[model samples]
Target: MNQNHLTTLLAVLDEGSFEGAADALRITPSAVSQRIKALESDMGRVLIRRTSPVAATDAGEILAQAARRMALLQAETDVALERSISRVPLSVAINADSLATWFQSVFSDVAKWKHATLQLRIEDEAHSLTLLRRGDCLGAVTTEATPVSGCDVRELGTMRYRPVATPALKDAFTSDEGIDWADMPVLRYGPNDAIQESDWRGRLPERPRERRVSQIPSSEAFLEAVRCGLGWAYVADLQSDPLLETGELVLLDSTHVDVPLYWQHWRLQSAMLQDLTQSVVDAAKQHLS
Candidate 1:
């Protein structure tokens, strides 16, 4: 089978439709279909599910991943052969908090090179590894310490969060001894957010049966909501320190939650990957616990 077929399959999966892939690859939709059909015929299996937004079959996923790996290796090979000075794109997944806080510092020096492009896919720290598992990115910043298959995991550092609220909220709770914590409005990033509840559980004797959570998905917006006294939340210590000092936000407890982070990347023998990994580790050590 032609290697180009695998590349076509990847394009189709990335774009989510035949026409979209055609547009991206600068090929006609008919050509795209022909390549896919030929690839599937060569594999002797149905590789794609033929959905409106096309999805890969289990077999297709394997081939797609191989295609991605090959592309990366080929790019590196080209760089070495031609001694290319052009920027090479590297796609990575990272959590919003890291992006908001310390991620940029990791690439500060590299950014000046102007020969390294990063395509960042932001997800929660706890979930970023799913992108690596799906073969969507070459590297990820995640809370999971365990390495994914064919990947290496290195501890970055610990990030700390503390439960905080406005001074007014503290006054309200003090006046009501029978106050149900659940009824009090809580701030959360999304449904998957466990920081608020987890902190609550550790501080209080019992878990709240129900929580009146206000969802603010954006990390910046979530911090702003907390600053504006919309609701109490577990804000990153690094982010909330200034507010806490100024008495804009009050720490409800002295207890701190530490989330250990890790960097996971494909176990490829590539100099560029090694340089990036070292840069991340050095920056993380400077910023995190």
Candidate 2:
């Protein structure tokens, strides 16, 4: 495949539109469209779907993955040969909870590395593997233990989550007959978040008739919502520990969920990627259960 065509394809996908891609590539939109057309003709397949915000077809995803890998290798080579002045971009996916806690240390360590730049895509741990499979990210901190094709996996340890709420909310919602599942407000990270539901599924006798749920997507804000008596939530121990000790938040139940996390990355022979993996493993050791 032509390098310029592949680069143009990536720009369009990354920027989400041909016009946006033209701006990114410093070329006319007509030029961008022509390159894409030429590449499609060469490949004999429709790669990009011409929709609002645009999307890659199955073949497009495959090509995009290859393009990203090629870009990484070229960037590494250029830096090694002193032929490029730009730092290598390392894209990785991480969950919101991990980003707000154990993963912060990874950022701290990476900041000291001068030749690499970190680009993070925050997704739910269970779904982060999608980004890896799509090649939108080169590495991921995910819940899936099974490795994607051409990738390697490592166990990072378990993240324990405790059902917690403010004292006032707990007292109001619980009694001697057992806690009320219905009518009590609950918190979730987002629609994709199953942490709260999974934690309650095994404990409850049956599904509640009515569930009052508030979706707070931001990690820091989600924790704060729990502290402010918005609702009960299954919070990671990393964020709940200090609050539990200080009586700012109360554990609502004894049963806890331990989510095992793993680091999945492309099987590459790059020093920067290896260094990043090592840094992540080291940080996970100190924080996760």
Candidate 3:
């Protein structure tokens, strides 16, 4: 069945009237009627229960769900064809932080809609590799040093972070704690971040009191909190560049943490994965240090 028929059926169920469905679908009522008739004839069943506010017949509900799945699969197929070579599907598991700040430009450069069957899932970097190990994704941008079995690994480089603060907050915090990082309130990306714990403890003059902690799950929001003066944060280089230039935030000191990243993928001879891997590596080489 065509997309038009599937969409028409869904719209009819949503709007609850043939006329209303037609208006929502931007098709003539006759056209909507024709498509529904075609779907009914094709399925050999009465799919919709016609009413003032319509409902799907049992069969209609089944077909509607199937149609929704079909549309999603079709989109995947279309993206694969337009994105990369045939015979390979593109899918990935990644941390939300990387997706929000740095990874989007990789897709923008491909310039085709059907190049690969792109599947994307978001997880934390501390945990994304589990998806690959379970065979869900072909590759990942992760902090794992140990490669998953059947996959090869490459060092992508690091995301450098330093403590940062707004001037006013720094002034108040310094007055209270005397500019020692150990005693300051810090913002963490998540419980598993391990970043500041790795970098700051024992290195600072005073033992860290960690006055208060705030954790924002997404990369974008975590940085935004720092930019808004919520707390001191370990914002990455690429993430901090603009804020530093604009003078919204300042580096706490020369001390920084480098979150060494790696690239890992199934060692399969698929053209689609190969191209994607190469592109991502190229981007990493240019952007990460």
Candidate 4:
């Protein structure tokens, strides 16, 4: 396996275009194309789909991950030899709620990552594992306990979300039969978000299809919207603390949903990754439910 070609392939995947990768590497675009072609020939498979911005084929994704692990080892070796080291940014995927709540705590120690740059890709907790499977990120905070192929898994902790709304809205919706959620405005983070919907199904006898829905995509904004009586939302316990304390938000129901979080990473022996994994685990222990 040619390391240079593998590195070029990963660069193209990361940058999403040949010219973009060339600009980052300070090489000519023509040179970048040649390297990719050589790599495809060596592997006897097409590696990139030349779209508006390039995308990797399945084989390309596998090779790109291999390149990442190889680069991590090489950087470690160079540091050990007292050679000048070029830091490759470590890309990770995480859910928005985690990022909004406790994700920053992982980076509090600068001494632990002086040689690395951490890049975070945010998605919903249920969908974060897709980024890992596509090799777009090396590690992810996800709801998936099952490890992706060629990866290791660890339990971080559960994130509990309570059904909450403004005090007036909670009062208006409550009845002898419980909250009248069928006609209430429901806050959804995005189109794919099913947390609110799931909570509805578990508490009520029907689905949330007939309810009025608002798309408040930003996590912080979502909380604010719920607090302002725009609608009911399942707010993370950590994020709802201050609002609950100030009586700005009121629980619609005592029933809460617990989403179990797991850390998934490549099965590599790099010290940098090991340190990062431990930092994340420790932070989750201290902060999460």
Per-model CA lDDT versus the true structure: 0.83, 0.92, 0.74, 0.85
Of candidates 4 and 1, the better by lDDT? 4
RMSD of each: 2.5, 1.4, 9.7, 2.2
Stretches > 4 Å off in candidate 4: 83-85, 110-112, 174-178, 202-210
Candidate 4 lDDT score relative to the true structure: 0.85
Clash pairs detected, candidate 1:
none
Candidate 1 vs candidate 3: which has greater lDDT? Answer: 1
Name the candidate, 1 or 4, with the larger TM-score value.
4
Worst 10 residues of 1 by lDDT: 174-183
| Candidate 4 per-residue lDDT over residues 193-255, each given as its tens digit | 878767667767967566688999898899889989999999999999889999999887678
Using TM-score as the measure, the top candidate is: 2
Summarize candidate 3's per-residue lDDT along 46-102 as a digit string, tens digits. 988878787778788767755644544555565555744332345688776677766
Off by over 4 Å in 3: 1-89, 110-115, 180-183, 203-210
Q: Measured by TM-score, how close is model 1 to the native structure?
A: 0.90
| lDDT of prediction 2 | 0.92
Task: Write one digit per residue (lDDT tens) for candidate 2, span 1-289.
Answer: 9999999999999999999999999999999999999999999999999998999999999999999998988888888888658688899999999999998898888899777899999999999998998889999999999999999999999999989999999999888977786667989988888878775577677877677889999999999999999999999999999999999999887978889999999999888889999999999999988
TM-score of each: 0.90, 0.96, 0.64, 0.91
Question: How much is 186 displaced in model 4, in angstroms?
Answer: 1.5
- In order of listing, the candidates' clash counts read 0, 0, 15, 0
